[model samples]
Target: MKKLLLGSVCGLGLAAGPALAADLGVPVRAAPVAVVVPGFSWTGFYVGANAGYGGGKFDYPFNAFQRQLQAEAPAIESRLDGRLGLTSGGFILGGQLGYLYQFDNRLVAGVEADFQWSGIEGRLSGTGTLTGTGTLPGTFSLDAGSQVRWFGTLRARLGYAWDRALLYATGGLAYGQVRSHADISAANGGTPIPGLTGGVATSHTRWGWTVGAGLEYALTQNWSFKTEYLYVDLGTSNVLSSAVDDPGNGFSAGASMKVTTRFHTVRAGINYRF
Candidate 1:
């Protein structure tokens, strides 16, 4: 009986061994799955294409009569205003490249460069007759026009960003090339006024400054869309000067033109961030 009881007890303990081991085996658990999420940032480099409209003022001032020929000068000057107002406008298309950085406080800053093909142009003309100048009364006519062919900008941007959207103010160097044409005729009164007929067409590069503001929204991690407005001023320039001699009137005089080009542009663009 003692041997049998001892064997029986050993068998029971052996049978329960696996159950105890299962309950107390080193508790193993998958390391609490570590999860990490990312925040939105506007730090990146980008390239973009844009299309827009441009409009502005093209003013040409010529006062050849103001220069010489005293007798007929005042009479001719009085007959017509020596200004050609070529109100200007047209289409603008371009591409740009830029870099941007976002600060901890959501302040954003960047620099951008762009080149565009522009079709801004204007046309104007005026005609009148000169009388009582002591010479044969003369007929005067004037025509003028301007076209901005291409333009570029190197600008610095400052803005505040809200998650995926940015609001910015920009300003900097603006440059462009223009072609202008002007014609003047104070002819056909042999004794009245010295017959003078001349026209000038010229092309030159202009430099100026631009200031504006914009809003940009990110459409994805690597893409954005923006709308902006800029005011650009290329200052005033002289495009032509003229001189004529008339032994008939015993007077000689010259003509000149002064032009002022200033414009505003509104643009919409899509950008790819790198």
Candidate 2:
């Protein structure tokens, strides 16, 4: 009887153990996952393309020429006042390459070079008869024009960067090609003077300086967009004009004139940073 009771208790304990194990749910472990963090930086080299409009002043000082002609006939100087100066505007397209460095304090600095093609030009003319006293009784006509074919600049940039955007000022050396033309003619008693007509067309390269400001924003890790404004001054150029009689009987004269160029450009561009 004692052996049978011990056997029955052992069997009951075994059945209860299985039920307890089933009541307590087992926990399963899952695979590990990756966490990603993003960082922003502006230190890099970049290349870009740009397009915009440029407009500015064309200053042609013909006072010396007017004075010379006035000495021969004072009436000619009156017609010259309204024909010497003008404004020019046109399209500009170009590309640029540059490198930049950023500081922990959010200050940024860079150097850039760019070239552009331009189609800017202007023209003006005036004509009248010298009818007053102390002047030759003759009709005179004056014409002038100026055109800028292309330009480029090497510039230094300084800015403050906020996250992915920058505000900056830039200035540096500038160079370009300019073409200028001028003409003057006189007729006395309805007959053209033999050597009293002169014209000059000059094409040359000039160097100057430029200053401006811009805003740039980074669209992605490697791409950015920008808008900028620049003021450029290409120093003066001089052209000579001469008129002489064919038979040595007409008067011989020469005029010296100077041209100063200045323009403002606004452009938008996209850049690839590396």
Candidate 3:
């Protein structure tokens, strides 16, 4: 009886072990490998559009302007000495193309070229009181104006990119077209004098340099937004005006004017990377 009982218990243990093993079997497929996405890169070619405001000051010497009248109308020139300076401001619209490369250490370097249509301009008129010998002894007036119709720049940029954000400093060659005009008129006690008016108008293209800084952010995988400020200098231009000649009054004079180009621009833009 004891032997039979022990044999039955061993048979039950073997049957239970096989049932547990089948229930705990391994999975048919391994867990999906973890997917890893890489960080953003600033290496690409891009094209963009921008809009902003531009304004600044200029250098127009009164002495240079008086050169036209100093010889024949010394009295008039002396009276018109120490004249007015110009102030400029306007709207700007443009587009840009660029290429950039970002290093392993997050240092970014690039080159960009941009073209713009500028509405920045300035105009002013000055009047002086004259009471002197052999002079009109009245009021003399002068009018002057300047405008930057268009401009372009080719610049190099260097920056450190913090993932999707970049801060940079840029500088390079700048060129533009400027239009200017100056006029001189006089009157005795506010009455227009005959043959006492002369003026000059000039339009020229000039080249110079620009320096600035900017901040940019990646808005999407292939798009970015940026804002920047630039200080641009396009040099100066000089043109001589027709001399004031009055045979009846024995008054003869000539003038030369100067137009200096310098301005500041603050702009915002969006770019698409290729």
Candidate 4:
């Protein structure tokens, strides 16, 4: 009976030792796996403000204008000295609304609309010298002034984001209200002769287009700051005159004046993502 008990204990000990050894095999640890993606996100609406530099090309068509004066009266000839390329500097404050879509490959695309309040005032002036031989045999001089049409654009922005920063370009339709003013004066016999001197101020809301580029840096999870430059080309429009008292004939002739303007502006702005 004793020998049988001892044999049973020895067999149980051997079985337990093998079970412990098997449990300790390999010392396994779970391998690390991907759990999250890294990329840019634009899942909300944003707004901001910015300030910077603005410049561009400008032109006014005054060639036919002077010819018209030459044809009207042989003694009347007008020439413009500086009538275009007026540099401007100002500030723009506005907001943006848009939706962002991110591709699976980390490519982000968004469509946004922005409106700006502009302080952009551009000025151009000209000097005209008229010679009267039939009636007066002396040279008379006159001066001209400029006008500013203040307006902004509704644009769409397309950008590429690298982590927290975005490099982008924007373009779309632009519209604004422009105000123009001009002065015409003359001199006779070395004394100021107030012949025909007045100003025409007209405000018109015109439509055009704009294009630009910019860079933005993220300030927070839902906010960003940006500095951008835009070039806006508002084509020519005509300015007409209503019936009024005429200086020479008590009759007013309707004249169509052409206006063409361009601009380059930069601004720093902040945006909040919704």
**Candidate 1 clash pair list:** 135-192, 136-192
Clash pairs for candidate 2 = 195-244
lDDT of each: 0.83, 0.80, 0.82, 0.59
Query: Please, what's the RMSD in Å of model 1?
Result: 5.0
Off by over 4 Å in 4: 1-38, 63-83, 124-126, 131-150, 187-196, 238-257
TM-scores for the candidates? 0.81, 0.76, 0.77, 0.68
For candidate 3, lDDT tens digit of each residue in 1-274? 9999999999898998767777888345667998899999999999999999999976676532221234454545323445356789999999999999999999999999999999999998877764455544666677889999999999999999999999999999999999988886766767754434567788999999999999999999999999999999999887434455666655554445677889999999999999
Query: Which one is best on lDDT?
Result: 1
Candidate rank order under lDDT: 1, 3, 2, 4
Per-residue lDDT of 108 in model 3: 100
List of clashing residue pairs for candidate 3: 68-254, 68-255, 69-254
**Cα lDDT tens digits for candidate 4, 1-274:** 9999999999999989867877889354689998897556755566655555555544544321122223356634332233345555565566556666655554566666666666666566655554433443233332223343355667777777778878888888887766655444434455433333344665667788889898888877888888888888777655322223345642322223445766777778788777
For residues 27-116, what per-residue lDDT tens digits would candidate 1 score against the true structure? 556668878977678899999999999999998876655223456455333233466667899999999999999999999999999998
Number of the candidate with higher TM-score, 1 or 2: 1
Better by lDDT, candidate 3 or 1: 1
Worst 10 residues of 3 by lDDT: 63-72
Best by TM-score: 1
lDDT of 2: 0.80
lDDT of 3 at 97: 97
Lowest summed-lDDT stretch of 10 residues in model 4? 62-71
Give Cα distance to truth, residue 197, candidate 1, Å: 1.7
